[model samples]
Target: MAIIGILGTPYNTVERSPFWWNKVSYTRQSFIDVFQELGHTVIVLPVDKTENIKNYLPLVDKIVLTGGADVSPYLYGEEPHAQLGTTDPIRDRFELAAIKAALEANKPILGVCRGLQLLNVYFGGTLYQDLSLTSSQIKH
Candidate 1:
């Protein structure tokens, strides 16, 4: 069975008890479900634990970047457009490093939605920031 590493997003929880807690999480069940159905083991890697990613690389057969926040425009040398939503620099940094490691290790890398965009940007490609701003008639 192939071992897979799935990147997680940061989340914050609002508790009714007058305090809120911040969390690092991966919400999509399909990523794990599909992989498990295929007889592979899934490992959810939190962004905060990036420093230890290298230690886990040899143990995983592949790295999967699941859907999450936008890639910070700053990574591609552009200012945030008015339509840009909140971006996580920490996640960006970790994922980019993870991608490089995966490449060097000759392991396969899979990317969903936002994950796809990040892969593009990492290879010197640019994003629309907001698809609606484009002149195309198609709506996303």
Candidate 2:
């Protein structure tokens, strides 16, 4: 059986668990469920220590990038835009490094939501806004 490594989204909250366990890292159960439905063991991939990503890659046959906060604009060389939503820089660091390591180690990766954008940006592509300033319905 192959092990599936799913990247987790880290966030801080005051609810549930002990007070000291506020910072949480997780992915939607439904997202991980699909792999389990296919008989693969699902495991949350750790990106807390990006430098050690290569070491972890060998343990998983495939990598899954789950959805979460917006991709930090700074990552793509652009200043923050008002339209951009909340982002986690710490999560970005690990995921980016994880992607690089996955590719170098010949492991396959699947991206969801912001994860897809990361894959695009990593290959020198930029995010596109179909609406123009004048055409955009939302106020600046």
Best by lDDT: 1
Please report how far candidate 2 places residue 70 from its true position, in Å: 0.7
Off by more than 4 A, model 2: 15-21, 128-140
lDDT of 1 at 110: 93
Please write out the lDDT profile of model 1 over residues 21-140, one tens digit for every residue: 656466478888999999999988877656677987887899898777788999888999999987888888888998988999999999888888999998999888888878998765
Residue 68 in model 2: lDDT: 77
Over the stretch 1-140, how does candidate 2's per-residue lDDT look in tens digits? 67999987886676565545566677888977888998999888765878877777888998998877778878778887777677888888898999998898888999987889889988888764322424548542
Per-prediction TM-score to the true structure, in the order listed = 0.90, 0.84
lDDT of 1 at 20: 58
Worst 10 residues of 2 by lDDT: 127-136
Best by TM-score: 1
> How much is 123 displaced in model 1, in angstroms?
0.6
**Collision pairs in model 1:** none
